[model samples]
Target: MFAQIRWRLLLSYLTVFTSILVIFAAGVRLLFARSLTQQLTDRLTALGQGAATNAEFDNGRLKVESDFIVQQLIHKNQGLEWFNLNQKSILKQGNIGLNLPLSLSKSPIQFSNKNFNIQAVVVPIISNDNGKIIGYIRVSQSLEEVDETLTKLDLILGSSIIIALIFSGFSGVILTRQAMQPIEESFQRLKQFTADASHELRSPLMAIKSNAAVALKYPEKMRKSDVEKFQAIVSAANQMTHLTEDLLLLARSEKKCDRRENSVNLTAILSNLLSLYQPEATAKEIDLKSETGEDMYLLGNAGQLTRLFANLIENALHYTLSGGTVEVTANLVRSYLIVSVQDTGAGIAPEHIKLVFERFWRADESRSYWKGGSGLGLAIAKTIAQNHGGSITLTSQVGVGSCFTVRLPSVKISDNSQD
Candidate 1:
């Protein structure tokens, strides 16, 4: 049981960690990209502004005073161009062409020229003396280098994310294990207490019941009060015995033991269990019957399956009144084996339906103790079903009958296979 809980804890930790990491990584990537783009645009703007200073408008024509120096300033890294106010390119240098953006924008833009995709910025020049608009200077750089750098960054970030996920998964397991230590210890202590209590209590209970039986058998030699006292002791011991046996079973369920892989026939196990309870039903004037369809097969522990059904059937029989009908049925429903133990008894109240499977919980606290109900039967059934990767549910009404359905995983085996 703890093993299952452990894995679930591990997965939950991984899921939360992964979600947080992914969000952080995405934010980092987006911020990094925007920063890089802004840095490139700032560089282009600086160059474009500087180049505009060396330009002038002469005789209604654009001219540059230092063409060679401007070429040297641009170097081989970027393209430079000058455009007239009419949106026509006056001069092209470096890796640029006559093709430019539709307007001169202070911000950088992506544009395609004859040869490359360029990140460029355009700045308009005004004659300082006349305050008239002259021409615009466009400065640009090819995006191949920026693309290469960003690609390398992506690879680094991707590698970091993968490594972090693996580390988190490994560390999460260890951390979750350490965190659950207290719970595990508590369960171990409880199991030990149950084992010790059952072992210690059984001997005295057996002794008391044995002495009571012996005394009651020879009632002629005893007073009426003595006989009554022995009978009470016998009854109390029997109830204690049932409670202890149930505790022992619950403790066994705590261990994560490897289950049997052999196939068990549902039809046979239910049939045998039904036959064993038939006499009790007969004595109560109840009709006990089976509506089993076929001998469905499954891979599981036969003993546990037997006990699981036994608890359900016994509970049904106990709750049902005289002349009630207790029915057992099983069949294959897709991937599950639906086995139901139904009874036409005084059904459970709607409000108490959910509490039926709780350990030691009884709907009617004042009911007779002689009914032999320790209130752990449905709880045991629930544990067994869940441990087997199955489930049990109860449906009841105030005055109508009750039905307890158990769904277990089913399998098929050849006739010659081992039991």
Candidate 2:
């Protein structure tokens, strides 16, 4: 159980940490890309404005002087284009290795060409004399270096996230173990107390029951009131004895041990249990039946498996009304041996179904207690099923009936092995 808890804690920690890393990485990438692009746009806009100054309208036609100012604008990894107001490119400078449309923006506008991996900006030239639009200047630069740097940053961030998650996984395991230590210790102490208390109570309870039985055996020598009182004593002692036995069984079941070496004949076990309960069913006028094939086998402790099914059958019979039916069936479905104890009884309520297997929990507490049930029968049965690498489930309707099904891994037994 603690192992499962530790793994869950580690998985949750890794999930939260990974999400934070991803969000942080995305934010960092966006900010860095925006800053780099802004720097590039600013440089391009400055160059375009400077080059636009040298451009003049001659005879109502735009012309740019190829002087040092325009030449300086066409630096390494940069290009320039001057277009007239008619949106026609008249001059190109340096290596503008992309076929792009003329820029017609009145203000500095930045754009990119994915095919050429380039960033560029356009600025409209205004006449200094009359403040009329005359021409446009476009400046461009390669984005190969910027893209390379971003890619490197992405790689580093991804690697760091992976490393950090690995470290957090280790740290989470240690932290969960430390957190679980006290709870585990407390559980061990409680289990030990139960086992010890149950063991200590057994002697007194048995002695009381036996002495009461001995006293009742000689009814001739005792008053009628004394006889009834002794009978009640015997009954109470029996109930307490059963309760302590159940508690001790549950306490001992917590130990992790292998019980798979013994091969139990499931068919024989069921047949014997049905026979044992046949008298009680007959007394109640209940139609108790069994539908099972021969030679069903499973690997488990026979006594424990017997007790597991006995609890189900007994509980079924206890709740069943006179003239009702209780059926026990066993079959091999695929690799599992399916056993069901179905009873046509006052079925469980939907709301109380989940709490049925909780130790000391009863759907109708007063009635269940009066009926001589310790309320740990189903809980012990569930524990036994789980310990044997099996499971038990219930399906019921309030007005109809209840079916308790047990699924255990089936095993094949040869004739020689059985012999």
Candidate 3:
């Protein structure tokens, strides 16, 4: 359980962190790419304008002046290439070299190859007298610097993400362990208390039973009323025994453990339990009925299911007054088996319905021992349902009765021969 909790915490942290990292990386790449492209385009435009101004029309022949322009066009170790419209190589700057075609009619093209990107611009130069194009200039710039900067940025971002993930993973595991410590301690304490309490209670109960038996041994010397009182003492001790057992069972159920799986016939279990309780219902003048669909099969522990039903039925019997009705019904609903126990008893208040299933929580503080309840019945039933991948819900009104429903995944029979 602790391992599962830790893993879940780690996964949650990683999911959130990775999502933000991905968004940040994408945004940075896009913004940097846009900024670099704009800077390159601006530089190319400036170079093209300067070159156009330096070229002059002298007797119908283009004469390029300006020593600075000539020097820039021939500079070595720089990344710039230039070509004239007549497909003749003009001035070339930088170590990078390129070949030009004479009959070029295409416009400027910007393309990236491998790690280096190139931006080419074509500009037309006009004649001095008319608006006719004398020639065109093409300039290209290399994007090696931008590529290197972006690569460094990517490394920094990746490193930061890795460091953050390591820190978060460590923190998540520590926090998960700390959070579960109290829960583990509580479970241990509860288990030890149940064991010690059960053992302590058994001694007194056995003594009482022994004393009652001894009193009956000298029945001839005792009054009829005295013998009857002793019998009542024995009966009360037995009831206490039952209550202790139920309490222990509830405590064990609360501790998480795998339940044994077996094929359970809901209809059979309900029918048998109902039959066993029929006499009690008749004696109390209450109507008890069972409505079960044919062969409702489920996969769960049979013992837990029996106990679940017993507790619900017993609770219904205890609250319902004489001449009231208690009903038990089971059927298959789609992929689930639904069982409902309803009674015409003093129904739970709307506000208390949610708390009724909590351990040792009783709505009536003045509930008597004669009812033979320890207030753990509903809690046990809930735990059993949950362990079986199911749930229990309650609906009640103050004056009207209450209905407790249990829904569990149903097992499909290979053949529907027996409906």
lDDT (Cα, tens digit) per residue for candidate 3, span 1-419: 35667678779878988899879888988898788777766776677666766666667555555334435544521234344445455555554444545334454466665546666666666666776666665666666776788899888888988898888788877887888789878968877898679878988898998989998899999999999999899888988887788777776665554433456788889998999899999999999988896988877777888999999998888888889999999888998999999998878777888899987788772233235677788989998888788899999887679999999888755532222
lDDT leaderboard ranking: 2, 1, 3
Which sequence of candidate numbers ranks them by TM-score, best first?
A: 2, 1, 3
User: Number of the top candidate by lDDT?
Assistant: 2
Clashing pairs for predicted structure model 2, backbone only: none
**Lowest-lDDT window of 10 residues in candidate 3?**
76-85
- TM per candidate: 0.69, 0.78, 0.56
Taking all chains together, the TM-score of candidate 3 against the true structure is 0.56
- Model 3 segments beyond 4 Å from truth? 1-173, 199-204, 223-232, 255-261, 365-370, 413-419
**Residues forming the 10-long window of minimal summed lDDT in candidate 1:** 363-372
Candidate 2 — number of clashing residue pairs? 0
Pairwise TM-score winner, candidates 2 and 3:
2
Give the clash total for candidate 3.
2
lDDT of each: 0.80, 0.85, 0.76
